[model samples]
Target chain A: MKFKAFLTDNGISLLEKRFLPALDKMGKICHLYLTRDHAFFLHNLLNGDGIQSIAQFRKEALFDDYRISSQNEDRIAFAVDLSLLHRALRSVVTIYAEFGADGGAAAVPPSNRLQIKLVKKLPPHSQQAMPFLTFETKGYKSAVIQDVPISKPLSRTDVLELQAALDSAQDLPQTLVQVPDMNQLQTFVDRMKHVGDPISMSISKCGDLHLQISTTLITLGAEFRKLLVIGEKAQVPAEDRNLTAQSRSERAILRGDAMSVQVSVKHFSKSLQCHLAKPDCAFYGIAPQGACLTVIFQFFIPGTHQTDKSISLHCRLPVLDPGSG
Target chain B: MSSEVDAESADLECELDNVQGMVDALSSVRWKRHQDAVIELSEHGIVLVVEESSCVQAKVYLQKELFVRYEYSAQARVRFGVSLGLFVDSLNTFSRPAHSSTIEIRYPGPDMQLLLRSVDSLDACIYAEIRTRIPETISWDYNFEPAGSTPLSFTVKSAALKEAIDDLEWPGSSIQVSLQPAPPVVTFRGEGHGDLQIDFMYYANTDLLTAFHCDREESHRYKYKFLRATTSNIPSSVIKENRGSKLTIGRGGMLKVQHLVSVAKQSNSHSHADSAGYLQPSRIAYIEFFVKPEVDDDNAND
Candidate 1:
């Protein structure tokens, strides 16, 4: 496999400031899934005990003059230490901010360009070779290169497992609703931390959401009524029109019944860390059978409702046992 | 408790046009260590009180006039206990930062819960039912009588007062708060590893002290931790409203700090007049903190 790409100034800012800081709060390590057209950061995708997070970015939105070739469909997936990667990216961003982007607008000078490549760093002590994601940035008269160690590329089976996980991450229920205010949800979740650990998040088809925590001292709840129901129209299959017509009657029955999932407050709060991205809007939805709760963060064109599809974030928090309720 | 059939008309119900206004008011008294608070609703409004170790007590007064619609038909005052932090958090969930959501608050759910519902959201309804329990008797209600005939009292900018206390945080465990009549100034002195003193001197051009009163020179020592509790929770929003906090040395050197929290819609939206041509957005919440002075330390200082 051979991979090399030059990151745009916009890409450096987005990764260095918004995405990395958000992922840094969730965990130490995440799988970087890179394809010919896109780059995705998969956090805990193959369930452990943490909230599963997937952040996707269109390759064109980030890189320029990109090239990659691999034995497996031009795709590569490997584990990366988020902190290490963030530190490396931040240094490049710092150098650019100090010297590069300001004076030159049209074209990046030869020295100021940021080049990223996949290289093998053969440790002298061991015969086995290790791969690293290398970042090189030049500023003023000085140049800095950072190589972040990465896990070995996933085999075909492992790639298939990750693909399956990504497919399921899209399995959010159709009853997703636009949350009222992020500040409100954040403070509510933060305050409930005092009462108990496991919080029951119930979202109904009627757009009612109740977040509750009960302890011996108090059974506290916050209900949001009449929230705007939102759904991703692109995900629905055209051939499922008959299924949609049939489920319409079933949806009427589901309107009165709220699907409740018990999740650890830590996991729920961890997902809220996406707030750092300053998303234009955030939606809350529950998966079928209360399997997981999905939170989608989207960016919009500042003055208009048009969604900026270049970046997206999805968090699926696993539901704990229902015995607590 | 499910007996009230005409609950909407007979219950203690109130409407707040600005939910963040209420959040800002309650957040002024929220400290991380304290959670349990007593919420009492009467014809006047809601009074939320949280106490720490029976030494530092904070009370938030949401006047009935603050609410756009206040309906209190319950013959007896309704009182309940709730997690102050959780209540503030839940209230937050119902509000959108960009727009003020009209929130309707009602007490005594069928199961003795406090119900909060957002009324302005026609397509989306946001509500929370906070479980309420019988309120415990408040640890000691001070008579708040005048300390002496002259009555030691002073009004200073709340932000300045909080800053003075916060700045003294690094020096020692206890702080000596002294107000002398001759100079018309209030001083906070912290002594330990190093001594730090912050003073608010009343002058014509400065806005520090708006009002002042004193009987001779009064000095009292208060635990730095307890003093911090009184000011740490004063949400910055309240300070932006530009209000004064009054420090009254009540009977026996008990210090009472009073802060005003504007519950009105931000001035940008406050101009909307109701049908009565009387919907005044001049609502203000009264928050008072009473911290008992360290009595033995006072004797030692004397």
Candidate 2:
């Protein structure tokens, strides 16, 4: 059964208005995983003390936790586990947040301030500048700033502090840390080491397609925001190579594509673009201003003169870019 | 026969698609040159194709609090270029404080003996991108006064005063600031014994404005700097909009205060619902002119 696109309340409107069309144009996705945490912040905002709820997510909580904070100003942190996505299932392994939580029920009036952060996996050697995540409310259109990570390699003290904090539920944001689970690492390594034939099969056979993700956000100056993700890797096959491995285990030497994604939004209302490191490796196309897009890719047997596999599909959905005219 | 036609069309389309992809990649990857473009958000580290002829540098600064946290405050410098045209144009067009710019420190201190050349220029108009590794907590206030003296003297009543001062209490005595003729000098002449953080200044010669921001936990005093004639010649607008005037500490915000000055022989009268000329003077008072601490939480967009 195909997994229907499930968008939480907060993220529902955007998906219907923009992202749905983009996904439809791509057409390869058998199942799309719109997350629940995306809507949690808005729910908290409606409840009261929404900002506080978001602030809690900024602390050490589960990746699925909804958080908001208004102590300083209303802020929200929304995370998604792309590993649940059907297309990514066979490629990636575990994907989740380090820590996250709901800010509980609102204890005060709701603030009108709004902020958003989008995080996904990115490998090294990726472009630094990021595309903007733009949105609109009435006449007000704003883009949340994008912050790049300044790699803070964890120190031994940091590890110890995190271990202690995890053992005891105290000093969350400061002490809470997410180390790669050994089992998860081993699974990923094992997959990388196993050589597989080109993943060309009947559409029904591909297993869990998910996008693994992790992100941390920081607002630098008033004019900028930074979203930092650590150790992101998305692998794609190279061109001009025919996969003829007799067994799936024989093709261990092939290297998958590594992508670094940077999304930057300037001012509240301006152009937002994502700069990918290796443009050639990216088969995916981005719409201008991320307008409603229609993508069609024709495929055939790599080096064959025969015609056996044929599939045609069509989908329509809105695009994300509130500032676009 | 029909199948052959289909294959031919498919081959043609694939070839055309490959060529189109090459052209599209070239156009799509055109790099935009950015010297100090304001960071709108946080993503990953930056990577641009560095040209051998073009000198490229990226400089990002945080509020002093954040800079100190990153331990880069001492090393942080304005990104400069070897390109002469860019440098001269920068000095001319971008010299003054713009709406979204910051006023940064140009010198270390009196001891540093440094010039504005080494000082950091702050952008008062634009908020800096900031990320804090520490807990952020902050509050705000602004001083208000008429641009110039009018028929009506602004009063410091309880309510109007509340917005300017946090948790204020009547000093229980009179406070008078005398502007003596020491070549256009304005001193923080006060009599009250309390720890205070006062932002005192002169505006439109008829208002000796001393906005007292109180923190009972710490002893504070309101201090004024005596501006020389040469310095006073510069409009109060320039001073209020001083580049260094804006600083982001933890979470960022904008604050304001009114400028009031009293003309010679013209005493500005005041009453706390009771008309009495009693200036409250502190026994242990310290005064100095300094920039208000700015808490910058601009890291949201990095």
Candidate 3:
């Protein structure tokens, strides 16, 4: 396997300030998947019990002059500690900040650019060759290089399994509804954690979501209605469609049955950490079999409706048995 | 915020519009986990008192005047016991990121629970009902009296006061708080591995000491643990909005620390009933703590 890329100034910032830091909060180690089109950080996607996070970035969006080649169609996947990668990018960003006035063109000088590559190194205390994701930043009078050790490249079969997991994770529910404001959700979850271990999240067909946490003493809940549903309206069963035929507001209030799934409050709390990403809006959906609660964070162009497709984050919170709590 | 609503609300409901302020007030007194607190409702307002041992006690006074809507329907005072930590956490949920929260809090909920409901979410609502039990007998009710005719009081910045107590870190010992009349200064001395003395200059450092008054020089010793507990969790939001906290030497060397919590959002602070005040003092809620001093031979002079 081979991979090399020069990270653009904007790319360095996006990683240093947003994605890497976000991943750092989610977990200690993450899978770095480099392909022809994008670089993805996959967390807890395999051997999971914790939160599963996927942060994807288009190649040109983060790096220029990108190249990757492998025996298996130019794709490489390996696990690396997030803190190490975060430090590497942060150091370069700080150095560039000091010499910010040195650039005049559409980008920084070639010598000042940050480059990352996959390399094998022999440590001073060990004889075995170890794979490293190397970061090199060369300035006019200074050059800084860091080699962060990473797990061995995935085998062909491992790659295929990861591909299948990615496909399954990307599958969205037929109906997607925007969640309550993160601040409210944050406080709601805070209250719920004290009431019970697992919470029941119910989303009705008429765009109403209710989260209830119960204990022997009391049952606490927050109910959100008239939320905006995103994209295509999923096909509804004939009986449900007929039920939604009343006036919109009345129908929303009248609907009582909803698709509900029980999820661990610990996992729910971890997913709330996505607020650090500063998503413009977030949507909540339930995976098939009530297996996972999926949260998609949508980032939009600051002043317009244009979705900034360069970056994306998806979190899957595993569901817990209803009887567990 | 309208007179019509207030006139109507006073007859039978106890609702409030500032959930953030209530949370901030409650969080300041939540020094320990699972602390039982007494909530008393009267014609004047709500009083929440949390006591640690018989030596340390904290109280939050949510005057009816501070509430957006205050209604006292019960013919007699009502009291209930709740977990301070849980109450604060539950109040937090009603707050929204972009807007201040409005909530209606009522006692004697259908099942004798404390009911809290959010009123600000356009098409959404959040509510929490916490189980309330009968108030247990407390050992003491400390009614603070003046140490001297002038009350021997001084006001200092809340954040600075908290920092000073935190710096005196001599564990399992006593913190001696002394006032000097000659120079108008206050000193906190902690004795352990090495002696640490933190002095506040009332005459020179007028900025830190907003006000200073002492009839005579006096000194007192208090448990280091109890002294620190009083200022342990002054909320960050409180530090930003208010000016300072007041420290008074009460009867028998009892220390009283008072902090003003701005319950009214600054931009729209025009009370339904207009009034003039310092830093909108009338609109602010009050938090007070009475700490009984450790009797190290009455004259705790170094």
Candidate 1 Cα lDDT to native = 0.78
Task: Compose the digit string of candidate 3's lDDT tens values, residues A1-325.
Answer: 8899988877886787777777888899989988889899999887668889999988988999998999988999999999988987777666555445555434455566778999999989999999999988765556778899999999989988887888778988655789868866776687678766678776655576777776665557777776777643433344543221112223332442345777888778778778877788889877655677889998886698878998899999877763210
Q: Predicted candidate 3: what Cα RMSD to the true structure?
A: 6.2
Instruction: List, residue by residue over B1-302, the lDDT tens digit for candidate 1.
Output: 12232566545888899888788889888877557899888998899998888788889999898898998988888778998877887787766656777988888766777877778844445556678888788874755667767878888888888888889989999999998877777888999989998887876526788888875888888999988987887867656656678889877778898888777764455433331112454587889889988877335433
- Tell me how far the alpha carbon of residue B81 in candidate 3 is from the true structure, in angstroms, after superposition: 0.2
Instruction: Categorize the docking of model 3.
Output: acceptable
TM-scores of the candidates in the order shown: 0.77, 0.16, 0.80
Best to worst by lDDT, what's the order? Answer: 1, 3, 2
Better of 1 and 3 by DockQ: 3
Which prediction has more favorable lDDT, 2 or 3?
3
Candidate 3 pairs with clashing backbones:
none
Which residue ranges in model 2 land beyond 4 Å of their true spot?
A1-256, A260-325, B1-178, B181-302
**Model 1: what TM-score?**
0.77
Model 2 chain B weakest 10-residue run by lDDT: B10-19
lDDT tens per residue, model 1, A159-269: 889988898787767778778888667866776676677987777665656676766544555666567777522222334222212132133234434567789999988
Clashes per candidate, residues 3 or more apart or on different chains = 14, 158, 0
User: What 10-residue stretch in candidate 1 chain B is worst by lDDT?
Assistant: B270-279
Model 2 agreement with the true structure over B232-262: per-residue lDDT tens digits: 2222222222211111111111112222211
**Residue B153, model 3, lDDT:** 83
lDDT of 3 at A196: 68
Query: Could you give the DockQ of candidate 1?
Result: 0.22
